[model samples]
Target chain A: MIILHHLNNSRSQRILWMLEELELPYEIKRYERDSKTMLAPPSLRQVHPLGKSPIISDGEVTMAESGAIIEYLGQKYGDGRLIPETGSADYRQYIYWMHYAEGSLMPPLLLRLVFEAIKSKPLPFFIKPVARKIADETTRQFIAPQIKTHFDYVEKFLGEHEWMAGHKLTGADIQMSFPLEASVARGVADSYPNITAYVKRFQERPAYQRALQAGGDYDYA
Target chain B: MIILHHLNNSRSQRILWMLEELELPYEIKRYERDSKTMLAPPSLRQVHPLGKSPIISDGEVTMAESGAIIEYLGQKYGDGRLIPETGSADYRQYIYWMHYAEGSLMPPLLLRLVFEAIKSKPLPFFIKPVARKIADETTRQFIAPQIKTHFDYVEKFLGEHEWMAGHKLTGADIQMSFPLEASVARGVADSYPNITAYVKRFQERPAYQRALQAGGDYDYA
Candidate 1:
């Protein structure tokens, strides 16, 4: 049996959407992040030592990391359905976007997040001003443009075809949709109209709606 | 035929080693990072816009990202030699280690680099002493122990087992060896004897030497 340990308003929304896309019946084990601190609670460590989200168990094997989980599921349960078989051009493109989503696309956005939170401290400590400068400079000077550019790149790629990978919906779309949506949620998506339109199409999918029902209140807040 | 677009003293070292481990004949097109800035030169952007190293072109397909390239090579040429066949426990473990090398293990160390670079910069006018306090406090309080703790995890894991993927030297070893040697080169390995021993074992391999020769100065710095 496949089991998904999900966290609401977090990356697990992608996993849920993936499960729906695969039409794979699975069990959901939900956890909530600390509201005031916006941190994952210590109780999550009991699920896995890493104390992170979107962990899955298949048979007896359990693992953390969202990218790994998405890759594993595509390999294990939905090989024919969600993943492309190896060696074909389609398969190559599938694998490329799979890695691209986490590898090339995410670092700057995440660094931007950490860069911002460290600056949110009300009192200007010895470290506060520097943190604020890095975040402020980064968001305006580097990160915002980069995120918009990557989103535009994705939009142009999508224009050439339908889905992120190809004509069919593959796991790459499933994996990428969450982060793309989260960017919109954080208001960064407003600058990329192409991404906004693409995301709207993503929302219209019944599978996406089903995932939201299972996963709970998720939106650009 | 395999073609590697490489640069000296970069991640290309690992890719070259991988080709050697597979005993595949390949051509290297090399680039040098800017001596002044120590960043990959803009010339690399001609190959891929990311301006990163360790890209491989096998026939018509070109791939970037070290983790992706390693997996691609393992799947293509080193199937029996490096990675396990698809749908096996060995294959599953191989995937885990591949992701772990670049994702979980490398991030924290890289984060330290970012923090240090922040400190290395001249403190802005009026905030100099505070920045020093933050940098000093961070180095003593967090970075040192966090690094030690991470390496210790590797040391203990390696101490009990012959290799990272347990009993055998699979592609996981090749994937992780760069970072392990890197930790050593960066002065993080001295504290972990078993990790040092493991690095020695890796260095003793003839194939590793060929890869190092191909990579020029990189060969684990």
Candidate 2:
């Protein structure tokens, strides 16, 4: 049996959604991140040296990264189901979105969270302005365009189509679902009406509900 | 026929090496990074809105992002030659390394670059102390581990095995080749005898020679 180590309000929820969509039998081990730091607990490092959430220990194979996890699960569990074979056009696009979610997308999300942390904290006066400036530049290079251009692209994508890819509901949508939700959780997309409506649509699906329930900790705020 | 819009000493060289590994025919439209700022050439935007490296135009399909490009090439040109089939264990490991190269490894590289930039830049005396502190902390979180822990893992693995997976060459090795080379270029791994030897092994390959020749600005120093 596959054992998914899950955490609330983390990318791990996407894994649960994926497992649910595939109807794959799996066990969930819940992990709650600390309230203040919002980091996956240190105990996680024992599971994998990376100490990240949404990891899986399937018999002998222990893979950690979420993008890797989704790709692995899609291959191992959803062979005839969630993911299309590599030869298909959708598979090509699927890999793009799968990598894009983390590679192209998450760096800015991480920088934003770090900037927010610096802002919220009572810091020594000497370094705060420099920190803010670096954060601003990071925003210019990665964050601003990501939300404006990429989010607009996603909104346009969700506008004409119900899913991220083809007519079938594949893991790509589930792969992207949490980050879009986190953008909401972070107030990053407060003004994008299409995305707001799209998130609502995603929330209405029973599979989404089942995914959250199975995940054990995801609150979907 | 494929057209690769490439820049010298950039991540695009990885794409070049993979093309050599597959012996795929291609043309390179080269651009030099601006001497003043050392940024990727402005011509990149013409390839994609994001203005990134390793954008390939195969007929009408234009793709950006390095990992996506490698996977695309593997599926489209090499078929099951460079990467494994989608459901195989080799395929799963291939996907992990694909994500690992960018998701886990590259961020530290860029972060370390950022710190070096902050340190070496001409700045006011008042700001240097705080700047040093920030650089030190960021380096702790993002930079130091890639060389010490990450490359150590790579060093040991290469010592124990002939390739990244099984006994055969795959795209994962191709993906890893650039980073290991880059780490050497960055002076990150002298202490690890095995990684140093592995780097020498990969660098001496005929395909690597072809890639360096095709690249024109062969600065894989």
Candidate 3:
């Protein structure tokens, strides 16, 4: 049996969706982010020392990192379902989107979150404008352009293919979901119709709806 | 023929090392970062719209993301060399380290670089101290602690195994090389002897030397 250590509204949701899609039997041990910090609770460290979510344990094997988990689940229980066959062109594309979701796409989005948090932190009235200026400038100069580039690249891919990797809805789409959902939450979705449509299609899945119900509240969608 | 589109002192160097280790015939197309911005040159966008390093083209396959490229090369050329056999404990561990290198490890390190750059930027004299305070505070409160956790985790793993996955030096180690090397360059290596030793072990290898000679001017080692 697979035990998913899930954090509500985090990347863990992607794994839950995958389990549902793959029809794998699994149990979820839910975690909640601290309301103030919006960070995962220390309770998660017991599951894995990294204290991050989207970790799973199957028998003696426990693992962390969403892409790793996605790949492992896809390989083990997927029975060749959500991933393209090895040595195929679609397989190469699948690997790119799966890794790209976390490797390249999430960094700038995460920085934007951190900067926004910094800007909203309680500060002396006098220094508030200066902090705001720095945060806004960093977002404008560094984060926004990179985010645009990534989304544009993703949009172009979605324009050509029904799914991220190719014609099939695979683990790449599941892995890519979080960043794109977060992008929608950040109000950048309107500019990219294909991405918006992609997210919509995922949400419309009965399996996805089941995962959402099981995974708990996710404001991003 | 395999073509590696390398950027100086970037993650792309990891691919060069992999190519050498696999004993594959490959050519390098090196792109220098802009002297002022220290970002990948616009020329890279011509290869892939993401304009990132560590991209490669094998025949018609053009791909980016280090983990993806590592997995692709490992599957296509490895012949069960740099990666473990499928459905094994080692393979699961291999996947974790490969994705964790970029997904979890690189983000904090990259943030540290960005914050340092922001702190050093030419700003009005009066605002400079404020900027430094912000950067230092973010480093102290957020980035530094996370980085320490990651290093601690890596150290624990290396303490157990010679390589990232198991007894073998697999593509997982190759994927992990960049972040560990960057940690050393940033002067954090002293805190984690295992990681330092791991980097040293890889550096001593002939393939690594060959990669360094071909890749050019990586100060991290």
Candidate 4:
């Protein structure tokens, strides 16, 4: 039996969504983030050394990294539905979006989160303004611009195709779901209708709704 | 003909290495990073909207993201040499490493670089120490520990397997090359002999040498 090591409100939600979409039988071993730290609890380290979510164990095989898990499920259980045919143009785009979601898109979004957290941390009266200035300047000069570029690129792509890869729903969409959801939560998605619309379409799917029921509260959507 | 849109000392070097390993004929259109901004030149934006290095074009297909590019090359040109056989445990491990390299590993390394840059930038005498404190605290509290965890995890994996995916030098190693190289350049690889040794093994390969000769100056080695 396949067992997903899921964490609340984390990237693990996408795995649950993919599992639902594939109609696979899997058990979720739910983990909660620490209330104060907002980090995956230390107990999760028992499942995967990285203590990361969306990890799954099928018999003896234990895997981490959402893209890898998504690809694995698509290959082993997908019956050729989640991925495009090998050597096709859609296959290339499929590969690009799957990797791009985490490799390119998530990094800046993560940095933005970190900067915001840093900005909010209580500081001495004298140091507060300096800290805020650094955070704001970094956002303006570095973080925000990169996020905008990525969103712009995605918007342009979605404008052309209904889905990330091409005309069909594939693992690319599942892999991309979390980052885009987080973007919507950040309010950046308001300016990019294509992205917001894509997220809305995803939310409207019955399988996605089922995943939401299986997985716990995810406020990003 | 396959064209690699390479930038000096960037992730694109891995594509050249993979091309050499596969013995595929490919041309390079090299772009230089801006000296001051340290960002990819605008010329590359024409090739891919993200303007990131390691974008490759074969005929009409233009692709970005190193993991995706590595997989494409492995699938289309590998002749079953660089990637493990499908449905095998090694193949699963192969996919995990390919995605983990960029998805899990590179982000912290990139943030460390950015933080270091922020720490070094000229600032007003009064604000200099405050900026340094924030950078230092972030590194100590957040960045360095995560990096150590990643390095420890990699060291353990290399201790068990000669290559990233079992015993063979698959594209997993190619995908992982840049981050490990950056680790060495950061002076962090010394404590992790397995990582340093793995990198040494990689650097000693004739294909890697050929890639260096063709791709020009790479200081990480």
Root-mean-square deviation (CA) per prediction? 2.8, 2.8, 1.1, 1.0
**Which tens-of-lDDT digit does each residue in A86-203 have in candidate 1?**
7777777776777677666776677677557557755456567665665576468656766765777776776677777667888878767766888877787777777777778888
> Which tens-of-lDDT digit does each residue in A20-127 have in candidate 3?
999889999989999988899999999899999989989998989999999999998888799998888888889988888889999998899889988998988877
Interface RMSD of candidate 1, in Å, is 2.6
- Chain B TM-score against the true chain B, each candidate: 0.89, 0.91, 0.97, 0.97
Cα lDDT of model 4 by residue, B1-221, tens digit: 99999999888899999999999998999998888887899998999888999999899788889999999889988888999999999999999999999899988888888789889988899998999999999989999999999999999988988998877799999999999987887697889999999999999999999999999988776
Interface RMSD to the true structure, each candidate: 2.6, 2.3, 0.9, 0.8
User: Model 2: residues >4 Å from true position, as ranges?
Assistant: A34-38, A137-149, A152-161, A216-221, B141-149, B218-220
Write the candidate numbers in order of decreasing TM-score: 4, 3, 1, 2
lDDT of 1 by residue, B137-190 (tens): 555664566566567767877888787664667778887887789888877788
User: What is the Å distance of residue B24 in model 1 from its true position?
Assistant: 0.8
Which pairs of residues clash in candidate 1, taking residues 3 or more apart in a chain or in different chains? A185-A220
- Give the range of the ten consecutive residues with the poorest summed lDDT in model 4 chain A: A159-168
Q: Given the true complex, what DockQ would model 2 score? A: 0.55
TM-score for candidate 1, please give it.
Answer: 0.90
Comparison by TM-score, 2 against 3, better one? 3
Model 2 RMSD, rounded to 1 decimal: 2.8
Q: Please state the Cα-based DockQ of model 4 relative to the true two-chain complex.
A: 0.88
User: For residues B135-157, could you state the per-residue lDDT of candidate 3 as single tens digits?
Assistant: 99989999999999988988998
Q: Estimate each model's TM-score.
A: 0.90, 0.89, 0.98, 0.98
